[model samples]
Target: MKEMEPWWKRSVVYQIYPRSFMDSNGDGVGDLQGIISKMDYLKKLGIGIIWLSPVYDSPNDDNGYDIRDYQTIMQEFGTMQDFEQLIEEAKQRDIRIVMDLVVNHTSDEHAWFVESRSSKDSNYRDYYIWRDGKGAQPPNNWGSIFSGPAWEKDELTDSYYLHLFSKKQPDLNWEHGPLRNNIFDMMTFWLEKGIGGFRMDVINFISKDEKLPDGEIHHEQGYGDGSTYFMNGPKIHTYLREMNEKVLSRYDVLTVGEMPGASTEDARIYTNPENQEVNMIFTFEHMNLDSGPNEKWDVRPLELVALKRNLEKWQHALHEVGWNSLYWNNHDQPRVVSRFGEDGAFREVSAKMLAICLHMLQGTPYIYQGEELGMTNVKFDSLSEYRDIETLNMYKEKRQQGIAHETIMSSIYAKGRDNARTPMQWTSNGGFTTGTPWIRMNTNTSFINAEQAIADPSSIFYTYQRLIQLRKIHAIITHGSFQLLLPDHPDLFVYKRQTAEEEWLIVNNFSEKTNQLVWKECNLPQTKGNIMIANYDSPKLEGDMVEVRPYESFVIAFERGK
Candidate 1:
C-alpha cells in the first residue's frame, strides 16, 4: 500500500501583490506580463504555489477586492489572454496559481448591484441585504470595518444596504439560492480554466444573523461591534459544505478561507477533513497580539507571552484534525521584519530568524513578496502620502475626535496597511515600473532591493530559499508533533518537533540581546546533533548551555532515542 499525499502538505506558497510586484510596458503598475517575467525567480526561490491577490474587474475603490465582474480580468492587469499566458509560463516552472476569491461583496458598479439598487421590485433586489431605516437613522448602530456606519442609504429605493466594508462595496445576500448558484458557477468557470485553487477573502462573514438587531457599543465613538452577528454566523458551515459539494469536490485543488475572529473551536469544524469545508484557514488571533485594547489601529509593542499562547493554541487544536496556513506578512499586514524584529542594524539576521521560526512549524507557510529580502515598513512623513482607504478613513475619524495629530500619525505608522503595500524594492524606483509608481516607492530601495540581496550569499533571500528546501524534504517538519518550550522566555522562542525516527530542536532569539539556552532544560542528550540549518555561520553549543546571539536561529536534527 502507498500513502496518499496532499499537494499542499509539503508545499510552500508565495503571495504576490500584483500591483506592487512588477510592471510591464512602463505602465507604472504591475500586470500579468510582469508576473510571467518573474516565473524563474519564484522557481529559484523553491515556491510551489503562487497566491495572487484579486485581479478581477473593479472600480478600484477598494483596490481589486471590489470585484465588478468575476469572469473578466482587470484592465490594468492586462487582458484574459495575458493571464492565460501567465498561467502557461508558471506551469512551465512547476508553479501553481491560486487566485484571491472575494465573494463577500462586490463593487456598487457591478451589474448585479446596479440592477439590484435600480428599483425596489427588481428581480435582483433580493440578491443583497436591504432594510428600511428606523426613522432617519440606520437600521442599527453597526460600524464598518473601514470606520463608519455599516449601512448606506439608496435614494432610488428608499432603503439602506448593508456594507461591512467601504460603502462602494455592498454585501451579498447568501440567503438567496440563485445568488449562491451564481457564485458557484463563477468559481467553476475559473477552476475549469486550469487555475489551481482559491484563497477566500473574509469567507466566514458570508452568513449573518437572522434577526437584524442593534449591538452593544464597544468604542467611545458609539459604534457597535457587529462582527458578532456576521463573523462565523449561523449558516457559514452549511454554505461552505454546499460550496465544497457543488464545485470544490469535483476538482483536486487547495482552498483556504481567511477567517477573522475565529477561535480554535471554530477552526476544528471549519477545516476538519471529514467536514469537507476547506483545506485550511488563515486566522488573525496571532496577528492581533500587538493591537491595543479597543482597536487594531491603537498599536502596542508585541508581547511574547500573548504571541506564544495564541500560536500554540492553534497548533495544538489543529494538529489532529485540521491544518493551518502560516504567515507573518501579507498584503493586509505590516512587514514581519519591521513588526516583530530589529529592522535597523540587525535586519538580515532578524528577518532570517522570523522566517525559520514560522516556517519550521507544522503548517503550510506563505511568503509575501519582498519579505524574503527583509523589507522594512515605509516611514511616510505625512498622512497625505498614504493611499489606503482604511488608513485615510481612520485618520479622519481620529482627527474629528480631538486626538492629537502626532499621536494618530504614530499609530498609523505602526499599524497602517500601506506598510506592506509599498512597491517591492527591486532597484531604483523599485524596478516596479519605468513610469511613475501608483504608490510612492520606499526610499530605502537603494540598499534593501532584491538586486543587492540576490548577489549576497548571506542575505535573507538565500536563507529563505534554504528553509523552503528544508520543509520540502524533511518529514519531521511536515508531520511531526510540536511541543513549545520556554513558554515563559521573553526573548527566546524554543520548540521541539518529534517524529517516529527523528527529533528536532528549533531555537530562535527574536531580540537584539544575547539569550542563553540551557540544554539541560531541553531533556536531550549532551551529545551534539546535526545542524540542519542556522542563520549564523557558527553557533556555540556548550555542554549544558548554548549561547544564542542576537537574532540567531538554528534547527538541529537528532536520531530519536540515540
Candidate 2:
C-alpha cells in the first residue's frame, strides 16, 4: 500500500497580495470583502490554499509587515468581522486561508512598544530589545535592511533599540519568557479562529545574540553585517519547538517559514518531521541566481546551467527528509515571466513554460496573483510613482553617491518588490478599483487582464488551472524522483520524474531561440511517449531528434523501462 501524505504537499497555493488584489469599496485598497467577492475565481483555479498577505492593523509601514496589533484587522482591510466572513466564504469552497505572520517585530506605535519605551521600569520594558548608546553613536554599526542604521535611539529612555528593517519597526526580545508566551497565546487566538496556518515572515530572525556585540563593518557602506548574530540564532529552534508544543501540535494545519539565507543543512533540521519546527521553508538561494554579491538590486544575467544546478541540489537535498515550497513569483519578487522568460513577444508562451517547469518539480506550487494572466513588470518613468520603502531608499542613497538616475532606475525596474505589487489587471481600467488605484496599473492590462485570460481557452490562466488539475491526478508529480538530463545544456532544461510504473520527461527551451536535440548525443532512451502538456499546440518528437520552438516545453509520460 502507498503511504499517505499531507494535504499541503499535494495542494497548490495561491498567494493574494491583498493591497492589490481588489477593492470592494472603491477605496483603492483590496479588502476582506474584495477577497470574499473573488472566492469563486480562486475556486475555479483549483488551489487548496490561499496564502493571504498581512491584514492585521498596521500603519502601512513596510506595507503591513510591521504589525501594530495581531488580532485586529487593519482599518484599510476592514474589521475582524469581515475577516471572519472571508474565512467562512473560503471554507465554503474548500479553500483554507493561511495568514502571513510577521512576529519578528512590531510597529513603534504599538501599545507594547509605547509602554516599553516610556521607561526602563515599565511592565512592558523588556518587550523589545533596548540597549544603551555608545557615547553618541548607536549601540553598534548594524545596518537596517532599508538602507540605514539598524539601531534607533529613543530619547525617552536615552537608549537605542534594534530594528532590522525599519526604524518604526522594533525587534522583539524573544529571550523574555513572557513575550514568548504572549506570542504563543496570540497564535492560539488565530488558530482557534480557524486559520489554516501561517506563512511566518523572517521567522528565523526572531532570536538574537544577547551580547549585542559589534560586527564586521563594510567601509563603502559604513554599516556592520549584523545578520550573523540574528539569522537562525541559538534560540530559534527552541522557540519554534515551544510554539509547536503549545499551539501548533493541537491544530492540523500547514506552516511555511520565509527564511532568508537558510542553508539545506538548516532546512534538514527545520522540516525533518521529527523536529517539527515547520512544514517547509522558502529559501533564497535560487531566487538570488540573477543577483550579485552586493544585494538583489545588483542585477545580473542568469545562467540557465547555474539555475539547474541550484534547483537540482535542493531537489535531492530534501528528497528524503524535508519538503520545498516551490515558487517563481511572490509578494516580494518581480514576475517570473518578465525576469526569466521572454516577456516581449512570447509573454503567454513563456509564462506557460515557466509554470510547467516549476510545477513539475517536487514541491508545493505557489501562484501569485496576476501570474496566471502573465503580468509583466512596470517601467514607471519616475521614482515619485514608487511607494516601496526599499526602492525609494535605494534611489535616494544611490543618487547622493553620484550614481546616474537611469542606472538606479534600471536596478529598480529589474528587482523592485513593487513589481509584484501592481494592482491585479481585472480589466483595461484595472477593475481592481472603480476609483483611483493605490498604485499605477500596468498599461498592458488592456490585453493581459484576467477578463481576457479567462475567456481564452489557450491563455496562461488555463495553463495554470490545468497544471493544478494534473498534479491532483498524477501521484508521480508528487512522489516521483527527479533527475536532470542535460546539466550542461545552455538553452534547454531537460529533466525526468520517475515512479515504479512510469517516467515523465519535461523538456523546456528557456531561451527565445529554437534548439534541436539529437537523441543520441545525451544517451537518452528513445521511447514512444504520451504528451501530457505543452506550451505550443503541436510539439511532435520525430524519430532521433526533438525540435522545440522558442520558449516551448512539454511533459511526455512513458512506461518505465520501456
The residue-by-residue lDDT of candidate 2 on 86-201, one tens digit each, is 99999999999999989899999899999999999999989999999889999888999888899998998899999999999999999999999999999999989998999999
What clash pairs does model 1 have? Answer: none
lDDT of 1 by residue, 443-536 (tens): 9898898888888888899999999999888888878998999999999999999888888899999888999998889876445589988999
Q: Deviation in angstroms for 509 in model 1?
A: 0.6
Q: The CA-based lDDT of model 2 is what?
A: 0.91
What are the runs in model 1 whose C-alpha is more than 4 Å off? 1-3, 525-527
Strongest candidate by TM-score: 1
